[model samples]
Target: MTTPVLFIHGLCLHASSWDPWIQLFRDAGYDPHAPGWPGDGATVEASRQHPDAIGDHGIDDVVEHFAGVIDRLPSPPILIGHSFGGMIAQKLLGQDRALAAIAIDAAQIKGVLPVPLSALRATLPVFRNPANLHRAVSLTAEQFRFAFANTVSEQESDELHERWTIPAPGKPLFEAATANFDPHSPAKVATDNQTRGPLLLIASGKDHTVPESVTRATLKQYRHSEAVTDLVTFPDRAHSLTIDSGWREVADTCLTWLKQQSL
Candidate 1:
């Protein structure tokens, strides 16, 4: 049977942003799918026009949403996720719901201690308002440039913002921000699962939203697990490494990693 792959997109980017990856993975003989988060509209424009539909969803809600998707698959899939989607991928993988997982510039999970100033600034648009926790928020192109496309050219950043950005729930951001304090935080992943499938975390050094230090901290969370856990760094890339002009390079790296794992 052909191995299945599921691509999970992060906040601000639409599920269609994975179109290129889906096609590429398909050509590589894998069945790939990219599903939107719960409450996402059918299209980016539609999502923009109806932000309420995308608001109020927290981290647990998203985890259950993707878990349902996994339940319907013929077999466990190899998960590849970017940003918030990366965190979701890790959660599902920890639950042993995937064959394997690759988390790219993943959001901070429970037990991750370093909250870099850049990460705080990247998420400030949402955290600025206490009420935003229950609302959907959209980033200005400037904020997008700072948080995601900082490593890319100005023109490319603007174009990417226009093409792929959408409003996303602030709940998950708030939840993640306070995860370390909450003993039962939804951001918690079963990092100690000794029998789970392999996990590869891809961190971008220039990422403002999830810095390399944060990824390194996340790696330490799995120190107790004998299961395969690996980390790779792209020293000059930013969070947009998955969707910017350099996206193919990141995707190719993931493909190569999978091959190395014999998946």
Candidate 2:
């Protein structure tokens, strides 16, 4: 089946982040759609002052919101999500929805381990102060380069920062940091290899937030789907692999992976 694709962006990024992948999916004859988190329509500067707009939003809220979109779509689309968006995708799989899913730069889900060193380092400024809960924490160009743009050069990093960096919800960061990924954790979603459709994990070659080891750790959670579970890493890329300079290769890899499967 020719499955439609929905691109769920990560924290601090808007739907615009997937601009590179939009046409690629369309050209491949797969429909691509991008939707923002509620209250994300505002520009980055505005969100910095009023983080509450998206602060109260939860994973289930996102899942149901997207489910409504899927319900109205031409078909049960394939899910393509990044970081926090990947968390959203994992929750959807618990519901046993969608045709297939690709989680790019995903955060840890319940039953999966959290190698929080990188993530905590990246998010320390935000969580270190409770007062920052309702505000946007400014990340310097250097900080952004280290946390997110390491693989990409300074020029590209500055450009990407200018073009894509935005205020994100602090609440989710705090919750993910401490939320015990247990059966009772509100963020926990019970997705085995079976409930989720053909699942693929895309890792950036130099992604600091979600390292290769962290991604590999996620594999153990869905051993039942080992028959179909797949992984590919772009060694020269960073966390924003979906929109980086070599993003076409990333998109093509997903396309190639999709074509090989019978979904």
lDDT of each: 0.94, 0.74
Worst 10 residues of 1 by lDDT: 1-10
**Tens-place lDDT digits, model 1, residues 125-218:** 9999999888999999999999999989999999999999999999999999999899999999999999999999999989999999999999
Off-target runs (Cα >4 Å) in candidate 1 are none
Instruction: List candidate 2 segments past 4 Å from native.
Output: 42-51, 114-116, 133-138, 193-195, 225-227
Q: Write model 2 residue lDDT over 1-263, tens digit each, in one string.
A: 55689988877676787877888898888888987776676565555556567665655567788888789888888888998888777667657677888888787666666565776677776778896655545567777777788887889988877777776767566566555644456467555545457788887767887777667777677775543678787777778677668778878888888888764
Clashing pairs in 2: none
Model 2 residue 36 CA deviation in Å:
0.6
Residue 91 in model 1: lDDT: 97
TM-score of 1: 0.99
Worst 10 residues of 2 by lDDT: 177-186
